[model samples]
Target: MALQNGFVRKEGIPPKSRSRRPAPDRRYERLLARQGLAPTAGVDEVGRGSLAGPLVAAAVILPLRIRLHPWLDDSKRLDSRRRLSVCDWLVGLPGVAYGIGFASVEEIDRWNVLGATMLAMSRAVLALAEKPGVVLVDGREAPPLEMPVRAIVGGDRRCASIAAASVLAKVTRDRWMTEVGRDHPRFGFARHKGYGTDDHWEALRRYGPTPLHRRSFLGRLSEEAIPHLPWDDGAIEPRGGP
Candidate 1:
């Protein structure tokens, strides 16, 4: 019911509180489909901004006749219940082909977040059952892949296929983090899903970084103050700062 400030809210005007963006349409997909790129896959990744856990990417190709669900939007905009429901529907819906890939915490430390994210995206695309004619990536830069790829900024909010990928990737990663939380309950992976929340920060100080925690993400943590994990990086970069 509220228009986002960046898109429609005017300076000095009362902010409209639209929780979700407008439903993504198939405009981009159709544009490419008309040009003989009928089987285009939408690409997106989750956990790129998280302080811990593996980055997950997904590529989704919808059938020619798609009737998008009304509640579908970027993963961040949906509640847990809605996200799970949409994910179930999308995964089960006929004529849809999807693939998910992950880049581990170790890979993030070795290659940096961007590189690892790209690697995950590439894997997802390659894993697809039907090779796509083109890829509509939901970011400013496309991953290095041997295919026709186009990056559309805010694509998850503007493209149906990209939105579906966002939902699938998010649901998949969230489920994983929740399960991992069961094994290591101290970090509250279930609550924060590996983000640097206040609870997570407190736990990190108390228990130190776990195997799931990125050593490269330790810039926010004091090197002298916190207990060192076995694989601590002495000179961690300050990417995705606190």
Candidate 2:
């Protein structure tokens, strides 16, 4: 990964040995540290591509002396079990400060996904228990904030702090969706986590969109007309009345 014009540009990484897991680069942090940017935070968001659920962001400031877990990587690269394990361990580590922020479905609908994402990122940064001197966001764009920020395109894969943020965001959001699944078992929220999976598509067609489903996202599906009771704003509420 490289930084160009304030965006993190991503390039393919060479295949790693099968026996050993690849490690995220620490140079991004080191470079900042050299410039006296101690307590730099890495921020990342998850659920942007999902068809439903809130966009969640996490910001984490890792301590200089703490050794990161070897299994850490992009959250997408880890299984559900591993992600949960890593999230649990990361939150408990001493000198690790973190916070989570969410942009609701309503917010996404109102602001558009990009705007909502930035809002979520900003909230994550502000929610941090320990303030950071600088923020490293994983993507082509950085959220607008008063503090200094750098956008690393492949930060989740190339930067350890961003990878840690990814894990935290993913795990936290996944757990939320699982609880939502329990509330609305018919939609299989736990199974697909609100992504546009075939099962989710089928559910949409069969049962219509859930109350939490993104109305804008539904237009893109174009698979079937999402059933919306006239009073329900095109999304099916889980109430008993047809």
Candidate 3:
């Protein structure tokens, strides 16, 4: 069997060999093993830095018995097609369960990005049909949750479970942004997926900001005109109304 792009089994582990001992999965495998936990859920988030669109989180309970795709590194390391393929395989696994949650642009603006990200991650874990014994979160900071949680810095790259969660979260958010692009054609969200790419900035420059644009993020583009209710004599009038 071909290993996934970013991973190779440790030197002593033969290719296609299944051993009772836990394979050297990644940097965090020893940490998870030391916890005396057999089954743990990994959590990760995507789109935290986008100029538009919601922050998406995913929690995944991976099957400890089976061999995972070797290319299972951080989602950012994989291309879109590979990530989507891995996501579909993960979602279809019998022992695996996954849940997705989103914190909208409005929520991000209201609570600030970090808080909103934590909110989305918490929601994803809570939404799982069956909670795992331990939750492995991919980041330096632990989310505020009632469950016993372990936060791993660079966990998405260091932990297999967290990497799976990252792939799922990334694919889910990208698909959502593509759909949102259909409704708001001017933003070309399908191409840039709400990232502040040159294409996105050009679109913002040409067509102005959309409802999905993060107004707080527009300070750099301060000269650009953003869509908002024009105040008349210090009173804002509702659009298409008297």
Selected candidate, larger lDDT, 1 vs 2: 1
The per-model lDDT (C-alpha) reads 0.85, 0.83, 0.76
User: Candidate 1: lDDT of 63?
Assistant: 82
CA lDDT, candidate 1, residue 203: 85
> Comparing candidate 1 with candidate 3, which one achieves the higher lDDT?
1
Q: For every model in order, what is the number of clashing pairs?
A: 2, 1, 3
By summed lDDT, which 10 consecutive residues of candidate 3 come out lowest? Answer: 233-242
lDDT of 2 by residue, 95-192 (tens): 89888888888788889999989998998899888889899999998988888999988889989999999999998888888876786799999989
What TM-score would you give candidate 1 relative to the actual structure? 0.86
Query: Which ten residues in a row are the worst by lDDT in model 1?
Result: 233-242
Per-model TM against the reference: 0.86, 0.85, 0.80
Segments of candidate 1 deviating more than 4 angstroms: 1-20, 232-242
The residue-level lDDT of candidate 1 at 136 comes to: 94
RMSD, candidate 2, Å: 9.1
Candidate 3 lDDT over residue span 1-242, tens digit each = 33545666576565665644332264454456577754677899988889887888998887777788866778998898888788878887888878887887767878988998899899889878887778889887768777678898878877888998899898888888887689778778888889999888877777677767666667767563544422121311111100
**Cα lDDT for residue 33, model 2?**
90
Runs in model 2 deviating more than 4 A are: 1-21, 221-224, 229-242
